[model samples]
Target: MQTQDSRARPLLIYLHGFLSSPQSFKCQLMREWLTANNPHIVFCAPQVLPYPAIAQQSLVGLLEGFLRSANCGPVGLLGSSMGGFWCTYLGERLHLPAVLINPAVRPSRFMPAYVGRVLRPYSGGTQEYRLTEADVDTMGRLEAELAQPLHSRYWLLSQRGDETLDYRDAENFYRSQRQTVEEGGDHGFQGFARYCAPIVEFLFNQQ
Candidate 1:
């Protein structure tokens, strides 16, 4: 459920990377900054299910519930890594503005090898979740759903040196939309904060 402040201003829904949570460093930092700098903007980062099977409809339902619950007028989506994949899928259906960070464009093809069983790392904890093939297949189907042509309502941010996801994926996917490709940065961009200012400006400035 959304908080009271979320009722005001445009909605900003953040989707963290695979095996990550809303409590991620970037998510927390953005939350604090937005709360102080743009209190009117609603910030939502739900803790999504780890498995791909539940992740698909779960994420969509969450977004739908958020919009209905808050009565959000306009919405902006920010997604990182695998979450970026989800943002693309949702953007197709919602037609809302979005900012994708090191997004996983072809995760269906990328993660096929590990479809049966996979281990995920947890943040600040020595724990991992064992994923099932069903989960991976569902995620692949979700990616397929978003394989349509790109729209103008999307923006992509990626770094060439990302070790996790190939930067080319984002470049190709969002080629028609606004894009910012950084050189020599890792999967987690070292200068994410620098990009945040412009992203916020662009999102808020949009019609």
Candidate 2:
């Protein structure tokens, strides 16, 4: 295990939302906030592939590689929307804490209709992203696997008026863990910058 110090506060692995790249607004905001507020923390936002099986495996492998390569111990994960789903799975597997923002708790069920020709967001244009039946099946299995008891290793941040995802889904999934539900904010939390300090404090304050 690596010792924490000025050079390494803690590893903050950020997983961006679906159809969004690692360079999404939320990820950029996080990088900037950390640079200004907590420069010691190492932040990593990897670009995930569009294919579900390949993406999940690649992300998990990358995360493990990062941990081993950096000698990071007890890292924290922060994911938004579909990325939140990944954070949930990784957090469980690694036995680490996570902060999920407007997480997609039931993506397998929710994304069934939008399975073809996904429009990439934040790429400055649209691209034809394929979603095969195999992808859906793999996601279904992942969902079932994730349905096991949560380790109480998460903090869910959700908004009541999220149009992209139903807040109840997160409310139900994280019912056993600590949650902070704000009113009137959309899927992307309104005034998200304001929550950065609090989130960092919460994650780093723990031993």
- Highest-scoring model, lDDT: 2
Off by over 4 Å in 1: 1-7, 112-120, 125-128
How do the residues 1-207 of candidate 2 rate in per-residue lDDT, one tens digit apiece? 544552444789899888788778889999999999888888889876656798789978987886786445458889999999999988887677889999998787766676775555656555657787778888888888776579747889999999999999899989998899998999878888878888887677874
All candidates: CA RMSD (Å): 3.4, 2.5
Looking at model 2, residue 54 earns an lDDT score of 86
Candidate 1 lDDT (Cα, 0 to 1): 0.78
- Clashes in each model (backbone N, CA, C under 3 Å)? 0, 0
Model 2 lDDT on a 0 to 1 scale: 0.82
Show the colliding residue pairs in model 1.
Answer: none
Q: What would the TM-scores of all predictions be? A: 0.87, 0.90
Predicted candidate 1 versus true structure: per-residue lDDT over 1-207, tens digit per residue: 877754457778899987788888778888888888887787899876667767767877877876786465677889898888888888887676788999988776666565555456456455566766666677667676775476538888888999988788688878888888889899877778876667777766876
Candidate 1 residue 6 Cα shift, in angstroms, is 10
Worst 10 residues of 1 by lDDT: 115-124
Report how far off residue 54 is in candidate 1 (Å): 1.1
